[model samples]
Target: MLFIQNIYLNKFLIFSSIIYLIYLNNCVYSIFECAPQETATFVRISRARLDGTPLVVSTAGHDLTCSQYCRNNIEPTTGAQRLCASFNFDGRETCYFFDDAAAPSAGQAELNPNPSANNFYYEKTCLPAVNAHEACTYRSFSFERIRKTSLEGFVKKSIQVASREQCLSACLKEKEFICRSVNYNYDTYACEMSIEDRRSKPTHLRMTVDQPVDYFDNNCLNRQNRCSQQGGNLVFVKTTQFEIKYYDHTQSVEPQESNCLQKCLDSLNTFCRSVEFSPNEKNCIVSDEDTFSRADQQGAVQNKDYYEPICVSADLSSSTCRQQAAFNRFIGVSIEGQPVATAQGVTIADCVSLCFQNLNCKSLNFDRTQSTCHIFAVGQANANVKKNPSVDFYEFNCESQFGGMALCTNEGIRFIVNTKEPYTGAIYAAEKFSTCSQVVENAKQISITFPPPNISPNCGTTIKV
Candidate 1:
């Protein structure tokens, strides 16, 4: 196991097995800053080859030398000055560089693992700690093992491995495709690498009680960032589509619901509060208004679904907001104050968004019965805030003190930041503001805040921070 650490210093130590590194230095503290040289880093995946035609291939003796080669080269074939994002290194010599255009999905590569083939694949990343799952201890990886079942089809590769461990190891090391699930036959010692799993291909999984085959779906993929790592998950409302009554636009997309949501999340300079997607028609309509924003505008739509992102609010049970501004929910009550703004129809989410967007909007009241949204400059402490059975009140948290807009991390961790807070958590550092910068201009200088301590699972894995 050859490990390379300290890329910024341009030096590396070759490790036989594992390396424990610890170092300290004085640096400006921020909500997104990393402790210098505190953790051992490894960039290359052992015995793994990324699946793609290399943009450039050259011979280099050392791993560090190959790394430099990738950074120095440009897309000569296309006459474009594109830098490589990843590279494959054959242990001895040979370097294959791949540009961003040819890069794999965020947090994934179509890696082919070959025990006989001595190869290593390295991708440049700012958050090496978060993305270095392959380099972590084998025990850190996990899978949902199901007995008497097998996910059929979509098998790109199958091989004979010694045990369940080796089978899983091969799946983890594969580079030819995103290996989502695996089928292992203990009797035949056959390992099947599948690109689809129960989540993506729900119907493909079948019961095989007679066979000695068991299905194992990789859990690591479930931890991949969503909501741009903004600490929220997509709430799918089935058979119910939001009507596009405000700031709505239509686009053609793949027939996947997630792709439709991606359009909403990926919108530039605009907040896509909701989306209506039709898988059958491959149509997506991203809108700034959801049912809560304009309750009368939405109705049932067959063959389509609505999606909205819900941000993680403060948990008063476990942590306090230091009495600094915080999101607080009040049921059966409404803030009574001079209206900053009022809408005829709105929901709690709409009220939250309105309060979040307007710097002056510190508190809001939503009347469920009347579907009315009222924003206020005052908060719950105001004496006028009185009981109203149909009204729900929400106050803007610290987001108002700073002009922080809602942003997502590459991994879908969400937080409101008006200024760049140094990332104090040591879990990860992004190569750049990976996903957020694409949606917000000049956002590369910003860093993601710590996500919730626990991510609720949709595909059977809870990520604990």
Candidate 2:
């Protein structure tokens, strides 16, 4: 028995020395040693500067002498105290501090054979000292183990999740969780998915594990009232007449919605606000009314009761306008610096119309001051007023043709005809016939001698003339 006692003493001394060293480094003032009657032991330091305010200390085994201390303070009062009834572990008694200032009373320690039977052992083996700069050890537990009688508003529902992916997907599907972090207990697979405005950050879903399971109170599903609610079949909000409406800038000018959409895509200006188009009228209206208000209806125009017209106030003079060119020779339609003819007097509109009518005219320049016209008959229209100048400018009329026939080339070959019918024969002569003999035929009665028939049959018949 003596030998065994000595061996235990040596072990206790060694353990105490290690605790002293830890106190030195961590600047802990108070230590708590607790061994619940449970299988896994738990030791805690009630007050330690370097040691977190609540610290756990336990030997690898249940052997005692895990003394906790404050720096340079041997005031037995400053030393660690026992918690619960002083139950002897192995042979030595476990101690804990009641408060930071009071001395530990050995008599007050009672033998606690059973500290609450339901006490759980968190698997965090390393009890780190709390520092202002350091992060506290966070315990994660599932809702199943956590005792919850009731929850307040804000947390609406609690559910057990299989994986982190399921938790995240659930949170995403819920519109209420627009901004909030999701806390999960991997042990219980219970998730506290909070719905908050700041939940957009993904860090809320992070999950870490300590060795042993811990209990977590799920406050995510505690809320009585939801952030948003679903109505019966309607799923829409009621609006007043003062609600403002927005539209696209090209909407008024486009003949159809499709055309307006296309124009919006093609426009270079980014300030275009909304588009309004009418299919019946084939008109599109594009406007920039950013600060439009429905209440301010004085200057607004109402169109067919469907839309209110916000005035498109723009400076017409400040608009970037181009003049039409009138002459061809003045500005070569193909090559630069080539001589071209100047057209006669014509207005800018008339010049454009003429250019549209002429098939060969690419563009024309009409001079407002001189009333002169310059038409581009062929090639690209390159007319500049400052340089090889023209008056006004217009693009050429290029119409598509079939086969090799140029429909717009000239006006001569405009029509064609086809014929298909049965045929009948008829003959007519218009001249009189004449005789071959005239006065020369006076010996008309003159007979011509004929050769006598040769043979015996002819000799009898010979006498007649």
Q: How does each model score on lDDT? A: 0.53, 0.30
Give candidate 2 regions above 4 Å deviation.
1-342, 379-390, 400-465
Query: Candidate 1: where are CA atoms >4 Å away?
Result: 1-132, 135-141, 222-465
lDDT of 2 at 100: 31
Number of the top candidate by lDDT?
A: 1
What lDDT score goes with residue 163 in model 2?
53
Instruction: Estimate the TM-score of every prediction.
Output: 0.25, 0.17
Best by TM-score: 1
The TM-score of predicted model 2 comes to 0.17
317-417 per-residue lDDT for model 2 (tens digits): 22222221122222212233332445455433334444333334454555545766665554443543344342323343233111111122121122111
What range of 10 consecutive residues in model 2 has the weakest lDDT sum?
A: 231-240
- Model 2 global lDDT (CA atoms, 0 to 1): 0.30
